[model samples]
Target: MLELEFTAEDMARTRFAISPLWEVVAGLRVLLGADEQGLHRRWAEPVRARIAAAKLDLTPLAALVPPPSPSVPGFICPPPTTPWPSLEVELTALRRTPRELLRALSPHARPGVDAILADPDRRLGELADLIEAYWEIAMAPYWPRIRTLLESDILYRARRFAEGGTRLLFDDLDPQLGWDDGTLQIAHRYVRGVHTLAGRGLILVPSAFVWPRVFSTTDPADLPVLRYPPRGIGTLWETRPSPASPALAGVLGRSRARLLTELAAPATTTDLARRTGLTPGGTSQHLTALRASGLVTAHRAGRVVLYARTRVAEELLNGAGA
Candidate 1:
């Protein structure tokens, strides 16, 4: 059992973020059968082939992550501190990790880990390079679907947090998590401790590949993080049936109807473009029309604007069989 006590400052400071780097690390664990719950079996098969075909080197990353260990090195890729960080930004942070933090990996070194710790500077750079390459083969292609699922969870959870404070925030977060008074408890597999957040607060990260288990980091040097599976992982990889009905598509053009349908969960123009295979410019034009017609409203979340369905649009969808 892992328990965390929160101060008032910690509560105010706690925030949500979606990390690309977290997916790369956790996805590898699932692919290699360490954290496998059969949720990602279909994803693992094709990604393994992609890695083999590209001759991607998994030695360094796989060493730090798997074969089911008690803990992973915090410096490998510390949790992202913001809602949206590009993979490149995360890789840069990985390369700049302080040398002293290398102590996290000094225990129970895996095969390739010894050689990596041997030359911290050079080895860390190579590790970052390898992670970037691995991202292209494993994460980039399917990121649209993965990110949409995560963002939707964030939106829903944020609202709950706002409405009911800490209790409602974590009440339904996961079976392994608990909240009472000022403490948050997590039923972690290999981690156990009682930590008081000395005003530094916590970061809640929702990961696609962390299904069936939860991960947390309590190092003082890093903002505390609890990584767990998002709400819709069971169907994350399945193909979604089109939400746009024939009549709706006829009333609006096929593209506009599809754009509005995608907004059932708030998303950005770029996200809609990738998911729907529409050009960015075309998506922007369609979104503009929808906004003008009051079918959708755009609200900014952190660095990006999220488009959500207005009540008018939701009612239309219900009546349209969408």
Candidate 2:
């Protein structure tokens, strides 16, 4: 078990961020056979075909994932300075990482990575360009959907914070995580230690590609970050039917019944509002009424509560609106 000791200051400064670069790396892993159950197969198969068609050389980037070691060096994957920095911004930052730091970390990396570390001035730029190419093919096409899911997780986590401070916020973060007193316990096979966070707070980053596992930055020199799978990942690639027929609108009223059909898949209030063409306040009010009637259920996934149709509602839909 790896434990992080949070000082009073660390808790105060802790924040959340979404990293596109991390997704680039994690998505590459899916193509590299890391996605055991094909959880990402729906997305990965096509991405793999695209990489093949483009003949993208991902060797240098792959060196940073699992080959050089289970632990990726922080120089290439530094914590983002903003909540949602662009991929270009992060690549720029990666390109600018001090050569001295690169020199310090270049001991035993594979040939692909060692080349970049050996010549940070020239080779690192090439590697950054390579990452950009990989991102365009592998990540950019699916970014909007990915970003929405990550954003929903952040919004939900903020609510958890208000409801019960950090305790509630960390409660459903991951099965491998635990919180008590002022420490966070992480169960990992290789990363085991007790580190103190003197002042630099932790960065909680939600990822769509890193499902079924979590990663933490244990290096004291770099900013600490906890990267975990966001909620709703299993259904991230699934498509929902276009707004259903208005058959059920009669019993539940046009608005409430529309929401009931929209719950064909779990969705956030904001998402439902936008899709259903209802105002946010109107969506919330309708959802509350539906929940009270046992026609809809609110499920807590990470920081956000996703509303889905209940069995009773499912029956009602098929009988009248199916």
Candidate 3:
């Protein structure tokens, strides 16, 4: 039972953000044990082999995510505000992790925790190196698709907020989360406390790897961070496409028809490219044609442009199925 007392200002300031580092850290948990992480078992199998083949030291990273404990440190996985935070930016924040914070985490020490506490800077450097290496091998290859899923979730939630305000957005986020009066409550198994935002507000992060459980920062000193698994993660590993309807394909051409169907959800050009097995440039061209025909609509969200099927396109899709 984690109770967050939110002021009106805090509610107004709550915003959605994506974190690459958070994904990397959350992914470590999936790799450490796959039995409980049934949603990510498929992802963990190949990723585990890669980690072993690359000879990456998982001890240090593994130390950060203990087995369902209440002592997990908040500083290690700081909430990231940027949609596409660079590795250097994330590591720099980690390098500046306070000695006291590291000390708090020392009790749950594993193979490399002692070294990190003794020489925070040097050990943090080594840890950052490990994170980068692990990320390159496991996450980078699939990041575009993962990011697209996260971004699509954000887009959906933003619309929800606009339509029904904060309560509706938080209510639908997860069964464990709720907003009543001025408080946001999270029913977590291991974490229980009442925390006031003190006008610091909250950062809602959607994660592709954090399924079946939500994560948050326990330290009062840190920003209020809530990380929930994004919708559509079950299909994150699915790459094979359902064959486009022959009627739709014949009328729109194979590539255009495929792109239209894929736009059932909002997606970036890169995501569309990866999903459709088309190049980004080719995907953009098809999107442009679709937009011109009013079958798709494009909207800019931060640095990325997302395309979704227009109402007209939805009707056409429904009619095609009939």
Task: Give model 3's TM-score versus the native structure.
Answer: 0.73
Question: Best by TM-score, which number?
Answer: 1
TM-score per prediction, in order, is: 0.75, 0.74, 0.73
What residue runs in model 1 are displaced by over 4 Å at the alpha carbon?
Answer: 104-106, 109-111, 240-322
Cα lDDT, all candidates: 0.80, 0.80, 0.77
- Pairs with backbone N, CA or C atoms under 3 Å apart (clashes), candidate 3: none
List runs of model 2 lying over 4 Å from the truth.
106-110, 243-322
- Once superposed on the true structure, which residue ranges of model 3 sit more than 4 Å away at CA? 34-37, 81-83, 109-112, 242-322
Tens-digit lDDT string for candidate 2 (1-322): 9999999899999999999888887787778877887898877776676677678777777776763256567777789899989989998988888867766774454545667766777877887898887776666545656887898899999999999998999999999999999999999767888999889999999999887889789677888999999989898888565444567776679888888777665577998999889999999999999999988776543345567676577668767844
lDDT of 3 at 180: 91
Among all windows of 10 consecutive residues in model 3, the one with the lowest summed lDDT is: 104-113
The pairs that clash in candidate 2 are 156-303
Candidates' RMSD to native: 8.0, 11.1, 8.3
Tens digits of per-residue lDDT for model 1 on 41-81? 76787678768867777877898888567666777768786
True lDDT of residue 224, candidate 3? 81
Q: Candidate 2, which ten residues in sequence have the lowest lDDT sum?
A: 297-306
